[model samples]
Target: MTDEAFKREVKTLYVAEAEDGIRLDRWFRRRWPHLSNIQVQKMARSGQIRVDGARIKPEGRLTAGAAVRVPPIPDAVVRAPGEHQALSPADVAFAKSLVIYEDDLVIALNKPWGLAVQGGTKTTRHVDRLLSAWGEGMERPRLVHRLDRDTSGVLLLGKGPEAAKRLAGAFARRQAKKTYWALVIGLPKPTAGQIDLPLKKTGINDFEIMRPADAKEHGAEPAETAYALISHAGQRASWLALRPFTGRTHQLRAHMKAIGHPILGDTKYGDAVSAELSGPLKLQLHARRIELDHPSGGKLIVEAPLSPEMRAGFQHFGFEEAEADADPFAGVRRMR
Candidate 1:
């Protein structure tokens, strides 16, 4: 059947034992990543999506053995299944080298800096394209989350649709805890605190950047970040561990800048002080660690070590990598 025809073909599903207690909206996201929240709500309101033959609210809960009526969803609202892509042996090997953890359901990679997770204008090489190497006769793995093109660290990929849905839910529900490490130009005065700042996107296209939102900005959203100083180089720079309670694009960068200590090497938001810092000019932000619920059950915690450039910067400042192992935000009051 044509792809469009196949997508529009209605299907009924019995809620599996494993999917019990999931929210209705989350259930749909797990099954159809392409469906927008608005689309799902529209379907539910229009009686196109039903559970046990009755229309349900988006936040309605599901139980095992429940019969779900899933209408013919359009192809545009579904994540396209992976297509076969030819990959060179060297490309395949390079992709495999980034794998820090993997299982039947998921693969976690220590994504290198400067590699885009997805393609965009003027961008060609990315983790998504390279994922073709992992196809191995199945659908290409799906991205469960994203890391910025200049940020390096633990990036997760779901092996299939089911796995992708589960992992994505973990992220959306704030069940995932992520730790980032960065080198900032100056130490935050309090040493450990939270930056509760709302942010909104500014500019457009290639020039786009995130800025602290004004009180009256139309689409500004709340953003919060918790940070603790791991070590400092005598006020010149500080090594910090950041935990973002709410994920926002460039939240850490913008929050740090708001506090007058923008992360070193972040050209978009860093200040003149950061620009004056000598040494490698690459962004110093790293996705150091992540903890989340695994699709197959139980908790998964993974860590990615510092890249060579970041390690070199750490060494130059006499900061110990072992210091990062300690909970930087421990005992600090959350600023909210």
Candidate 2:
């Protein structure tokens, strides 16, 4: 609740009827319940706020009544010494681009949602802190996989450190091939299915990872699958594509909020009940796509596109609006 009174607690909501696009940092931790959309996105990039006048991303969107501003929450730095210099200048003016695709092992970036490839409980600048401030004097970007702090898309850094331990051991055996594009809220009455269940970790920041309707914790033993591939309805919810094979911990957002099809503006499991997301919102999830196997054998893919508030709610539900101009990097670049 610091960051200068959380950007003077911005204002200008409307998107009623269960808060439209939602996601302005979980709508400013649900209109400021002691602030936390990661502290209103580290106070909207340390320049206070302004959505619509720019200085955006706290996953901005809150439609239905648009106008969100919320500016006034700066002053909060600490780490010094040229602030870990690399591509400094406040790390590309609070990271808006780092889209790499390097070689000689691996490197890929396109991520850009309140940024945090690792570090929680009130993050402290991540993506290994601007890739260790662009790895002063070279090679330091680790983390060969991780996305959540309001998931964005396609991140995989590793320029040394044994190619980040063989790309985090190929995402620990799952052979890395994620893929997501949520907009969920309802539908699964067979709208293309698969949920194999068997998850665990109830809570602790444990950051939710359910799937135990009590049948003795449903024989938990690592059983996830996510392979939907269809769901586009709207005006009420539906826009999946998921593809996880197993990578637990909020595995596709607690299995799409335990089959209730949450995901859309998911505030600790979507069901916020709007009123302007009360203040900041836009959950429609999106880590869109990812593929791997680049230890020199070739074939690696990355993707991330579909965030114009989930393409303006699929052009406000008017007959698919041509799937948003077909492949404007469709789900963020990944194909033969």
TM-score of every candidate: 0.74, 0.30
For 1-336, candidate 1 gives per-residue lDDT tens digits of: 444554465655545433445579977875556678998898888989888789999888876446677888655432333422356798889999999999999899999988887654345467877987775323568776677888999898878767876776676565678889999987688998788788887776467787888757875767778888888999899999998876676788888988899888888898776888835658889999888888989998889878876776787778888776645655544365
Model 2 CA lDDT for position 107 = 68
Report, for all candidates in order, the number of backbone clashes.
0, 18
Best of the candidates, lDDT: 1
State the weakest 10-residue window (summed lDDT) of model 1: 76-85
> What shift in Å separates residue 77 of candidate 2 from its native position after superposition?
10
Give candidate 1 misplaced runs (Cα > 4 Å).
Answer: 1-85, 136-138, 330-336
Instruction: Evaluate model 1: give its lDDT.
Output: 0.76
